[model samples]
Target chain A: MSLILARIDDRLIHGQVTVGWSRILQPDQIVLCNDTIAADPWQSKIYKSAVPPDIDVSILNKESAAVFLNNLPLECKTILLVENPEDMFDLVRRGVKIDEVNAGGMHHSNSKYEMFEYVYVNRTDIAYLRRILNSGIPVNAQSVPGVKIHTIDKLALDAIESIMP
Target chain B: MINGLVVTHGELGVELVSVVEMIMGPVSGLTGRSNSGKSVSELADEIKELISSDNDCDTILFIDDFGGSCANAAQLAGAAGSSTRILTGVNLAMLLDFVTWRETMPIDELPRRLVEKGRQAITSMGPVQEG
Candidate 1:
């Protein structure tokens, strides 16, 4: 498929994606799908600046990203980045085909609990992730390339059981 | 006086600061941090908090490498037009140069000097001169 790597990381266009994953994936284009960032020119500028000038960079909202990914050229290798699981769910719901989802970073907050070193999730995040999982797409948590990939199913199940009455 | 914060992947930052301090004696305004357990945003927030804690002095963030998580977090922390400066590819010579000239040099010009010093520190001995 043209869409090679689809990932969920809060810090989009950062080192892990740019240096770590990009070097391995070697995608021709990196597309960031986020509504808030796409809407803000200044924010878009900052994110775009982090990427190298050689590779193509596009920042589009969910709807536009869905359309773009649907029609992407077969030869164009692309890395799809979304900030959160909600965005991934929305993209999947909007008919953006993805082979697998890499869960990179979901930093800690009061509302979230640590699932892995780089992954923190709350009930809402778990629910959305479950929805994505149920759609037959595998979600794996791996911070950088060449690291061990952990499936989110067991962790999500444990988390869901803990939160339920 | 300008303060420096060394941020790296694991214990590299901490060890670099310690070695520099060992060579040049104790330094008061320099610290090291690790990105072992923290995520990018968490690391960025920690950097922001550190910068805000000592608001009087201009801070310089020494990152292990460019296009790494430490550098990325440093960029995020410094993106809002703060008085902080980020220098990637940090080395012992750069830290030494910073400690030596921080009090004398202006913050704006210090990064360029450190970059030069860091680059100059790397050299080959040309296959060991004949005795």
Candidate 2:
């Protein structure tokens, strides 16, 4: 119930999340919705150890996260972190209220459509984001708070070809 | 005057603050040191004094490591004193954001803002490089 901020940063957990995000978000719970990290004890331990002792970090997969998020206390500020658009789409399809997603850093990839210099989007990803935005969730292209904002769906997608080879 | 304290091991705490000062002007009344010599309980007691003295409704003590001595001290002090937030594993981006944002927003928003800033700072640029 306390899903304050949900981010889709490929980097599930790192210095930014443990040190930077933890400091800023001040969330009592840091929920990472990545299946791989959840199964691997070594990886989970490493991520948990990285976080400060004060905050609780849980690594859950997309399925379990749905159940967990339902039971989470309303008072606790929970941050849901995902790796890519696929995972986010999966969650969205499952009825997760992900309003206003900040495309932090998707990085450069040879995808079907080139949205921008750094972001290359495919048809499915583009459609998904367009739907999410049309639903009234403000999807902005802001890496940091200080950086310039780039409207995701509003970007000129006419020039972006659907060819991926 | 808002007071900030950085607590860490060896020179990590001081080094962090020095980096902050270099970029974002001078932060006055900021104190930091290694919490090695004293016991955990003793160190916590000392940190309490630091926070209480400068803790006039607004004070943040940045701890270098969460599981480390400095963070433990700040957490303990939080119970004794009022309005003292402890941020562990202090980093340049986080310190800058906290110090910069706290000036405008209310203290209540400090934690949320910190988390947002922290999320953006993380990067999966590549596999970790070993020197």
Interface RMSD values for all candidates: 21.1, 8.8
lDDT of 1 at A60: 100
Return the top candidate by lDDT.
1
Cα distance off (Å), candidate 2, residue A49: 2.4
lDDT of 2 by residue, A23-108 (tens): 55678988888888888776777677666678788888889887787677779888778877677766776777766676655666
Considering only N, C-alpha and C atoms within 3 Å, which residue pairs clash in candidate 1?
none
Cα RMSD (angstroms) for every candidate in the order listed: 17.3, 12.0
lDDT of 1 by residue, A78-158 (tens): 999999999999999999999999998888878777788789887788888989988999999988765677888856657
CA deviation > 4 Å runs, candidate 1: A160-165, B1-131
CAPRI accuracy category, model 1: incorrect
Which residue segments of model 2 deviate by more than 4 Å? A112-120, A134-136, A154-165, B1-131
Kindly report, for each predicted structure in the order presented, the TM-score of its chain A compared with the true chain A: 0.95, 0.79
Question: Candidate 2, which CAPRI tier?
Answer: incorrect
Residue A37, model 2: lDDT of: 81
